[model samples]
Target: MPENLTAEQWRSFVASRRTTRDFLPTPVPQELIDQLLTDAMTAPSWSNTRPYLVAVASGQARDRISTELLNRWDSAAKALAGGLWGKIKIFITRYGLPQSDYKVNRKYPAELKPRSARVGAELYGLLGIARDDHEARRAQWGRNYEFFGAPVSLFIFTHRGLGEYSVSDAGLMMQNLMLSAHAHGLGTCAQGATALWAKPIRDEFNIPKDYNLLCGIALGYPSDDKVNTFKADRLPIEKIKLLPKNA
Candidate 1:
């Protein structure tokens, strides 16, 4: 741990870290990325297995992946909007269907629904997008595949044999990476959407067969756009903590 950081400074750093949706096209330096990865590697893992792998893409590789991902997203979006015929087309072609190792569209549990809804509402509201505007929503969602114009994209994968523990370890490392990126004056957005289709990435990177893509992180300088300023509300600490059985 670095010295001279006061409690307040730590709190501010943690609290100020937000998911940046819009980023400048400026690329992050390779040295800075190396430093962040080094810091993130210090994150604790299950038995130090460190059962995760990361694929970092920039320049041409990043552009190619983004193009492929956008095509996939567009095909899916069109199919979903095309009604019965579109559904039939998707079923017949199997082109737009997600091949994610994990299901990304599962319904939220009843207890967490409100929290999810609130965050979604806040994000769309900031973007001046109405709830009924499906086209606008689809376009905004498509930006995720584009990495919101960020210059660096990181794809994280975990070992299948390790099961859920590998996922847990990956999550820990991801958090560390995001925090480290923020401290370095770089912005990040951890995107689950990027994991929806892995073929494009697999073609670009020589990932081991045992490792499965978990999610992606977009890294770059944040733009001053108003949408980048949106911050979702967090539940209070009291709500997050468990009460003593006797209390």
Candidate 2:
């Protein structure tokens, strides 16, 4: 264990970590990526099952996957705007429907909807995108498939057999990876949108049948774009804490 680490310092470091929406094209050194992965592996696993795998992409492979994902997104968007015939075409071609092992898009719960909406509003507001600007919004959303211009993209997978526990373990691992990257002057964005269509990743990687793609992380140096500076509000500690039963 490292010595002389104060709680205040740790808290400050953790608070500085944020989800980077824009990244520079500068590629992270392989050694640095390896070190971050090593640190992330220290996260405790449930029953030591460690039922998760990661697929890292950079250079040519990353570009190819990004191209494919963007193509799919474009086709899906056109289909959505095509009316009844478009719907029929999507059904016939299986183009618009997601082929993810798990559902990535779902209706938010009533209690959580406001939080989700608020963050989204703030993010788009930072980018000068109006709520009614469908075309602009679609273009922005398409960037997620492009890994937000990050040079490195990671796809996280969880074992289907372990169910929710596997997802929980993956979450812990992802947090560690992000924090480790942040500590090293790197940026990361954990993207659920990348999990919407797994076909592109499946085509590029030899992922096992038992492993389901959970999400993705875009890692690299953060760009100085104004969008990257947007910060969402967090709930207070009291709001998250449960009341004492005796009270």
lDDT of 2 by residue, 90-189 (tens): 8899975788888888899999999999998989988999999999999999999889999999999999999999999999999999999999999999
lDDT of all predictions: 0.94, 0.91
Name model 2 segments beyond 4 Å from true.
Answer: none
Residue-level lDDT tens digits of model 1 in 67-180 = 999998999999999999998999899887999977877899999999999999989988899999999999999999999999999999999999999999999999999999
**Model 2 RMSD, rounded to 1 decimal:** 1.1
Per-candidate clash tally? 0, 0
The C-alpha local distance difference test score for the whole of candidate 1 amounts to 0.94
lDDT of 2: 0.91
